[model samples]
Target chain A: MSHLKHVAIAGATGAVGVEMLRCLEQRNFPVGQLTLLASARSAGKTVKFKGTDVTIKELKADSFEGVDIALFSAGGGISKEFIPHAVKAGAVVVDNSSAYRMDDSVPLVVPEINAEDVKKHKGIIANPNCTTAITLMALWPLHQAFGVKRLFASSYQAVSGTGAQAIEELERQTREWAKAERKWDDVRLPADQVKVYPHQIAFNALPHVDSFLDSGYTKEEMKMENEGRKIMHHPTLRASVTCVRVPVFRAHSVAVSAEFEKPVTVEAAYEVLRTAKGLDLVDDPTLKKYPLALDVAGKDNCAVGRLRLDCALDNGLAFWVAGDQLLKGAALNAVQIAECLV
Target chain B: MSHLKHVAIAGATGAVGVEMLRCLEQRNFPVGQLTLLASARSAGKTVKFKGTDVTIKELKADSFEGVDIALFSAGGGISKEFIPHAVKAGAVVVDNSSAYRMDDSVPLVVPEINAEDVKKHKGIIANPNCTTAITLMALWPLHQAFGVKRLFASSYQAVSGTGAQAIEELERQTREWAKAERKWDDVRLPADQVKVYPHQIAFNALPHVDSFLDSGYTKEEMKMENEGRKIMHHPTLRASVTCVRVPVFRAHSVAVSAEFEKPVTVEAAYEVLRTAKGLDLVDDPTLKKYPLALDVAGKDNCAVGRLRLDCALDNGLAFWVAGDQLLKGAALNAVQIAECLV
Candidate 1:
């Protein structure tokens, strides 16, 4: 972990990419040099890393020439088109998109849960979904304690997961609602003026978090099952999830009822979660305290609270977990994977 | 069924009470005469009814005199204090509060599955929890078809359920954020000016919905188990729920994964829900269509979509349900219960 490596981050101007840069600095990652890459539109941009300016380069197949590790936070299409080039250029690629997640050849790594999986990566490792990674931070520790078999989860996903545009939309619409400048009845905004989401997100909940699948579940909803099975190494593990986009700016929160093969008591689950790495126990009902998005917005560790028995399922426990979706879900997880590699 | 009856609505100045007024007009409930009652603060306030002004009378022991039926949407304290008075005045009371919900003598009603439960009410009938009611609107119908035994649900509750002040707070903070009037550090506002909710409701998710109980579950979370048993007539029916308050202004949505005694199929569940009363099936995966808060905000019927089999549970099916929390979760459910009595 002490050996320095030259690293390049694609989509350097994007939200997750920026967070990746901050995470690398905050964690004091051993970086010999940093390369920032973006589309030609952002080629001239400069990002400050370690109090030094790093000019953004136009992302191209040749961009990975001198990079030992390439972290890609760009869209799936961009990763699909360029990740192979990075691998071919002799750089290990860590992709934060769905492009290579389900690929048998690519390992999906969450350092705490499956760091060893990274060793098997064929030059490319896929990052789990933001919501799934945050949830597994708490669930994996409990799974080790209780042998979890299945889970039912509902996510309160923040707008930042949709990118910078959606965050601005929430800010814009909220102001509009507050000023009463736009009554609910006046629906005549121009196309450019219309915000990120299909509807105003100021004071609303949208059930459609991602694209819908043929099975009626959104892609975000299926990620838990698909990615969970891959990460947990449980081919038969079951998951029923509903992903909702809330007005929250950052952090993703999930309420989960996980059924285990063995009986799970709140005390035992608490013991495991309290000491688990990257996890915090916030389950104090007496003080009216628990893990809330505001409390975990910029934190590294995911908070787990509201732990109890699932009254409906035998040997099942219900809990609520919150984590900075940008950190644990994307940037931090990617950096952790890089750390495990070195 | 054709006979009209004089109906009175208590707490006419409240959030749900106003929604009840609109629902009655929207559904065209058979009404011979209408009475609106409120506290002293709202007494003499004029509300429109059938294009005529009806002045609110101060709710008193005698307010229900000659009123054939009464819908109570006031807080528990008011319901506890005046529900008996309304009953003594010869009107059946359909209460939308927890005052009598868990009482052994009271019948917790959801018209579609438990309309018959109304006959068992001892002068007062109780509406289920907003989250429970909305989730069960879809689950109960499927339960009747599949013999449901257990459920795991997470609720995305709206701030409106907290009452009008919280709604105002969400709007206010959003506007404040939009205007950039206050950074996250500016905290000089007076305590009274802080407005509804213990924390800011804009751009945040609060895991605590209602006050917490000794058992660590919120009163809002336990409503599903306590009220669910009575409404479903399955004293042993199990439920594990995590209730959360989002910044949404109107609708309450729930993600439900229910397990039944018999084998459940998405096809069969779809068939049952397609014809279920008080529910609209809005599932269309390829078209990216499904139930959402924005779509169900001002509507009466609960909108259900994103239906599928639980990949995690045998004999389990997962679905998403949303309804105007103020309407079906409170006012409309109470009015429908009153309609059943007449």
Candidate 2:
């Protein structure tokens, strides 16, 4: 293949898909050609990429004709349907959905933690879940320093992680309250008004994310341990995560308490995270500077802060990690994986 | 003390103080006399209680002359100063500040867990921290049933937990975005606009809740284990909590993964939590019903749901708890402690 390769993005008009375009443009991927594919509904839409308008074409099994690399971010069903067609058409795929993440043949890559795994991919490389990817950006360094055994995490996930429609849902719901001169204490929209989520997302926290499995864990909550083990090559990594959707627009933050096999100190964890790749140590508590979702909204690097010794577990460390999910969790990670290829 | 006793509220103009007034009125406490105390600036303001307007008076060292029970929601310094005067003036003081929470002479009470501890109070009682109180409402029952050993918790705490100024700050910052007719994708206030919080609370999550201690954990995060042990009488209870301040106005929600001494099943946890005092089970996942922060905003009973066997730990269970911090965590709990006196 030539250094300047042909690249196609499936679901090119969605939230993550658009960010992938930005990442490609920002990273200056040597693109001989760029193909944007979306649903028939988004077919006529044109997105600006690097001072040029790229028209989005209707996505189909035949969409990947001469593409050297296909980035899939539509959803699981779309990836499951069109990925084989892309692979059969001779394009290597980097999927951003969960459909092929746990597949043994499809290597799940986080770039920083397991870039070498990219070489093991048969055809499709899987990008991790947003919250899992953001957390591992920090936890991976600590795990390298002090072998992590198990962790308990809770996610403050943003609405944009759900898609563009979910973002509109939050804005519309909140704008409804704003339009009415209601007091802050009494700010609420009707339950019937809520569409994207099971409940309201404005000024509220919904513990339910994705669909609930039979075991009472949401599929989103289970993704951390399941995907973390695969990416970190730590089969014994245990994670109990309660994924909650907050009203934040784009970034996702995770609070994690991890127990380690080796003795860990705050200073030791600080040293490891200070030099960690794709991560920033923002842990000066006295200055009231920590990793906040708002601060990390548009950044590529996930920030780690609020480092402390876990009082509940022996040799444990607790930290908060935040990142722009559209970037590191989905697009930038997928692009980084593609960079490993070129 | 008579069945109908005199009640005085210190810091009656504050958020929890106003809620305390409402709780006393709604719970139909026999109040023969009512006195409202506040700072000198709010001394002339009047608050309505049970269809009667009570003028606020400046709280002084001599304000507790005939009060049989004094509820203190003032800051810690006020509690430390005026509480001694109130105690000397023959009033049983129920403090909402953290100043005397760990005092050997003061009995910190969460009525659901330790109503009997109220009987042990010599002259003053302490209410648990808001997040800690709401979490323990659910965790204590599980501990009673399964003998909990340790737990990891992350709190999605509300702005109202910080009091009135914070509630206004969230509304003001968000209203600025809405009034400007800004796009939702660009909704943000200037960092300087953030007043009550160290940073903007609109569409953001702050992991630093309360002051930082020498150990790197915020004072709010450590309160879970410290106050949990005192309230539940579980001396060896271990809790690693990441206390986060979210943009929600009133209710606080916590996601907890607790390790128990005995093997536990989802059915057993459901059995235990179904009939637990001051906790409502809202755990039908198939129906898309779970404990949400919005639903529990003004509710007294903390709701627990999203129950599952913790995949991370042996004999572990993960669940979520949400409640109005003002009611159960502060105002209502303090009033219940006063009710024990009558």
Candidate 3:
């Protein structure tokens, strides 16, 4: 376990998969061997890892034969089908899909919140949902300082959270919009161009992020509370979340109103968040500086800003958090969990 | 007042101002004469109203001489300076600026919520803030049925709410990003190109919508509770609002968790929202149909959708409401208030 580990990334051609490679290389994650695995379509695609062209292999049940840590980010279905195989092949699986996140046997790990939970994983360690993970990067730190009771949050999610194809869809739509020289009033992307999302994502905001449950909350919306409780080890943490996909290409921003067991001040929250790992406090409203999605894109650290005392609830604080959904929300967090393994 | 009143639209060149002209024309406000007023920079510019070229005059203290109804949208500063003169000249002012909204003497009106309040105004009738008006359009109906006590809201506000220059800034910055052909990972507009906003609004979300208050909520954010209490005639009503400026050019959307005195259900909410004036119930998530910003843009009616029972609070309902910021939020609402006077 002390030696450099062999790492295999499933869905290597996807958005988060590619970022996982970068995080491994940038953070110098002591990888003895790196294997890139994807679907048959992207099998031969070459991804440059540390200036070396690593050919992506077709992901199969045998993909984790000699891999020590297999990172899965394809989708819930792919992770469900192959993650068990990775576990059977004696490889620890760090799954980025929601397929295994809620499983009692699987440890939902956000390294900063519950790194010790990584040690308790039998075979698979599930990566928290991107929105949930990014939120907890700040929330977990605050929860440590003041016991958090519940939160009401709304996410301004990005197109990249939908995967590589959705990113392409947004880019294509933006170009189509530019080509038409349409005024802002006529900015709806033509019906034919809006494929990835239900409606146009060019300049619109979609309130529905994931599939809706009978409770009327989207799966993505409930993931914040579901995953937050697990990651923070606080079973009673209630979260009412509205997941919205905005026009941004990368990075997700969340506005949260959290009520705590003890009274929380903006200054105290700032002091606690300033020293928190993998998070930066960027709350200066006078200068009009806060956690903006465009600025946080491609960055590892999640940024928290717009810190204020909630006017609605006693002992409540409202804040805005921005993080690269691909990095802190997905890849970088996954790789950091792998780092905790050895 | 009844015989085809003369209408003067201050800030007639701005986004909401232009929409005011459209609303007056579309809604057939029985305009005998239309006067367009703006700053000296746009003094001679001709804006087409009812297919007639109406020249813009500088909005001076004496501009409301022959005007019967003055719809002011220039800004708070201009309204403060010139509105007294408009009232002095015997023109009833439907002020769109926040200058007179909270004034005990000025009637802050949302036509749908309190059209009766228009009769109570001495001279100036204040228009509610864009986000607050859109939210109250839906909330008022539910409040009637269930008796709302408080609400926690987050707004996905469009750039048009910041006026015409901010709209242009978004359009120009978007074009800049498109021309650069930047990929999703590198999707930031150059720092030098960002203006009109403290941060770039293209493909990004800014949490700071208006100037911050000592309480940490932006002036724009607090307007909901402040204006809601006035418009709804409910002094005890509490609202915690987060106002965010998104890349969209028009249409402001709000996600609200409203707690009421009586019990609420999804069926009951739909029934109320469907019959509510100036609101369209657009809540069918199964069909992927909801109140989208793009669809709601340019539409006179505010759309309420994604109706669900709140999982976090007792007797609470969660819903998403979107409206054309220029329409129900400003221009059309102002025109409707003027209609009340007629």
Candidate 4:
């Protein structure tokens, strides 16, 4: 491990990309050299890091020449095309996309849960899905205390998770709605105004998240179970998830009803959750305190709340977990993985 | 049944109350006389009914005199204090609040499924909880086919379900947010501006809906199982629910995974839901079509979509349902009960 390493951030202009830059600077990851990479359209744009402008270069086969550690936040297509080059050039890749998460050779890592998995990475470590990472921050602790059998979850995902365009879309639609000065009941937007989402997302909830799979669950919904099993090394773990895109700007919240092999009480679950690394126990219903998307946005630590015993399942528990998808879910996790390499 | 029956609407100016007036006018209920009742602050305010303005009187024990049927939408405290008065005044009351729904003598009814229960009412008939009623519109039909054993559900509830003031709160906060010209990532609302909700409802989701029970489920979350038993006549039925309040101004959506005793298929569930009274099958995942809260806001019929076999449970089916909470969940159901009385 080098004391000071050359670090390159792919998709450096994206929502997660900007946050990766901030996390590196804030955490002061011994960076001797900084390189930013994006598409041709974003190439030449300068991103500020440590009060200095770092120019984004157009990603090419030779882009990873001298970079020792590369963090990828671009879509899966870009990762698939460019990650092999990074690996070939001897740059260890930490991908924040679904491209390589389920790969047998690629280590799917959430630093807190599976930092050991990073050492076995075949030059590519995969960051878990945003919602999955946020959820497992709390679930991993509980799973350690009481073996988890299955979980039923529903996500209140933010627009920013979709990228900068969706963020702009939510803001544009909201501004359009407010500019119209429409009363509460009369709030309506035309079809032409909504683009990023299939339906109007302003003041609405879309039950669809990622593309629908043949099994009826969206590709995004299955990531919880698929990624959870890999990261937790619990092969038989089952998760049923419904992912919905909400009007929120950032931070994703998931409501989980987890059934475990052992009987779990609120106090026991809290005991495990309170001391969990990278997680905050935000329960206290009497004070109206819970992990809210509004309250969790921009924070690195994910918050868990609304812990209760499951009413239907045997030896079950219900809880809500929230976190900034860009932080623990993406950029921060990516940087932490890079830290593991050095 | 009297031809010219007098009808009084308690909580006449509330969110559901205003919708109840619309349903009564649109459905053209046999209302020979209309009496609007509210608190003292709302007294003398006139609500237009069928080209006539009816002045609201302050609610009291005497207000229900000569009223043949009264529709109550006020909170439980108001219903507890005033519903008996309406019944004593010779009026059969259809209370929308949860005050009397669980009582032994009070017949909780969703007219389509349990209008027969209305006949057994001693003096009061209770409208089911908003989420329960909307969900049952789809679940009841399927339960008949598959013999539902238990259900796990999460709700995307609207602000309108909270009452007129909540609607105002969402609107006011949204306006404040837009007026501030804050970027999506920089949206930080002040504490004092939030009134109706414990946290900011704009661009956020709250997992707490109603008061939290000792078991960790909100009182509203338990209503599905509690009210479903009485309405569906399935006393042994079980449900685990997480009720969440989203930013939507009206209409509510629920993502449900129902495990049944009998084998159920997507095609079979579709067949049953297609002809289900007050339900429309809106699923077409290939085209990205599903039941959206915005699409069902002003509609009379609830919509169910995203039908798929539950990947995690045996004989299980997953579906999404949405409806106007003010209509099918409250006002229309209450009005339907009154029609049953006549």
DockQ of each: 0.57, 0.86, 0.83, 0.83
What value does DockQ give for candidate 3?
0.83
Model 4 misplaced stretches (Cα beyond 4 Å): none
What DockQ score does model 2 reach against the true complex?
Answer: 0.86
| Fraction of the true interface contacts (Cα pairs closer than 8 Å across chains) found in each model | 0.73, 0.87, 0.79, 0.80
C-alpha local distance difference test of each model:
0.84, 0.92, 0.90, 0.92
Interface RMSD of 3: 0.9
**Superposed model 2: Cα runs more than 4 Å off:** none
Local accuracy of candidate 4 as per-residue lDDT tens digits, A1-342: 468999999999999999999999999999999989999999988878999988999988899998999999989999999999999999999999999999999999998999999989889999989999999999999999999999989999999899999999999999999999887777679889988888888988899998999888999999999999999999999889999999999899998889999989999999999999999999899999999998888888999999988888989998999999889888999999888888
In model 1, what is the error at residue A201, expressed in angstroms?
Answer: 3.7
Instruction: For candidate 1, give the lDDT of residue A208.
Output: 78
Give residue A205's lDDT in candidate 1 (0 to 100).
68
Ranking by lDDT: 2, 4, 3, 1
Model 1 agreement with the true structure over B1-342: per-residue lDDT tens digits: 247878888989888898888878877888888899998999988999789899999888888888888889888999999999888988888889889999989889989888998888788898878988898889888888889888888888888898876766766565556566654323223345456776666666777887887666788988888788888887888788888888787888888888889998888988999999999999886665778787787788999988887777778888889998988898888888887887
- Give me the TM-scores for chain A across all models, comma-separated: 0.95, 0.99, 0.98, 0.98
Root-mean-square deviation (CA) per prediction:
2.8, 1.0, 1.2, 1.0
